[model samples]
Target: MITLYGSPLSGNTHKVRMALAFLGLPWDERLTDAAARQSDAFAALTPMRQIPLFVDGGLTLRDSQAILAYLAARYRPGDWDGHTPEERSAIALWLSHAANEIANGPAALRLARRFGLAIPEDHAAAVTARFLPVIEAHLERRDWLAGDRLTIADLAASPYLALMEDAGIDPADWPAIHGWTRRIAALPAFPAIPGWPGEGAN
Candidate 1:
């Protein structure tokens, strides 16, 4: 069995959990607090002290996006794994966007606030202002980021986007984005993280 180390409230960690569920893989979860992550044992497994470390058999992996890709490739045999060249490229593009822009922008601001980190209100506001429009524009007519079907792109982006409420950005404000989120929530085998309530529970 696989062992996942991290807090469920973490977006990065949640993404991995979601992927595992989507792929129908059973794994053990080891919950770790922020302080526990700095311990010698955890640090030995993940030098960077990041959340969502995956240990399966003899292979150990870090980085949530990489874990998601690994799960999809290992468990999903068809298009869901992005078998075609164009599909693979599209998946890479969206994954990069999710990691760089969305994660760094709105997700970072919300996490800073949640963790009681010193974050300027104006800075959070700036992130929200910039992020909403980009997401709104992309979600305008598309059912999913890559195409009509659900893919890792949706899993990679959903957790952080689901927490937009914490940033004081109402899903109601962006109809397309709101609808997209609902669709993601309705996917089969979607796992609910321990700390996070079900969709819209917050």
Candidate 2:
């Protein structure tokens, strides 16, 4: 059985859950959070103690992007995994962007706004201002993030990007980015990011 350890409301965790849904794989989820990570049991599982941890049989994985890549390549094969060398590199680039830019930009802002996290609001705003347009401009030339079809890259990036409003930014300001997220939402197997823009997307 595949077991995912993370909080459902967490965008990082939610992305992994979305990948599992799209793969049409039935799995169990263990609710984990910041406090839960402090437990000795959790620490024994992963020294990193990060949420969005995936356990399939004996293999234990941390980080949402890594988990998504493993799921795509392992279970579904060519369905979501990149087909070409260039496509794989492109997907890797977006995965890095998700871990750095998207995580620090909108995701940090949402944490600060909703949970009063100590992140500097101004810095996060600057990051978002810089990050959103690049995606908008890039999507103007392509339908998906990597290759000609949907891949784990889109799944890795879209959750936090969809939460622009939660970070005090307007989705209307970036039509291409907005449309891209809506397209993900329209996917038959896409799971909604609860309370975010993708929640009731058509």
Instruction: Pick the TM-score winner.
Output: 2
- Candidate 1: tens digits of C-alpha lDDT, residues 1-202: 9999978678888888888887787989999888999899999998889888999989999988888888877777445558688888888887987877777776777767666666666766676687778878988968887766888888888777777766556767777777777777667887765433355653
Q: Provide the TM-score for each candidate, comma-separated.
A: 0.88, 0.93
lDDT tens digits by residue: candidate 2, 1-202: 9999988778999889888898889889898878999999999998988888999899999999999889888876765877778878899999999999999999999999877889888998899889888999999988899888889999999888877777777888888888888888888887766665653552
Off by over 4 Å in 2: 198-202
Model 1 residue 81 distance off true place after TM-score fit, in angstroms:
3.7
Give the Å error, residue 96, model 1.
Answer: 1.0
Query: Whole-model lDDT, candidate 2?
Result: 0.86
State the local distance difference test value for candidate 1. 0.78
- The total of clashing pairs for model 2 equals 0
Off by over 4 Å in 1: 119-125, 193-202
User: TM-score of predicted model 2?
Assistant: 0.93
State candidate 1's TM-score: 0.88
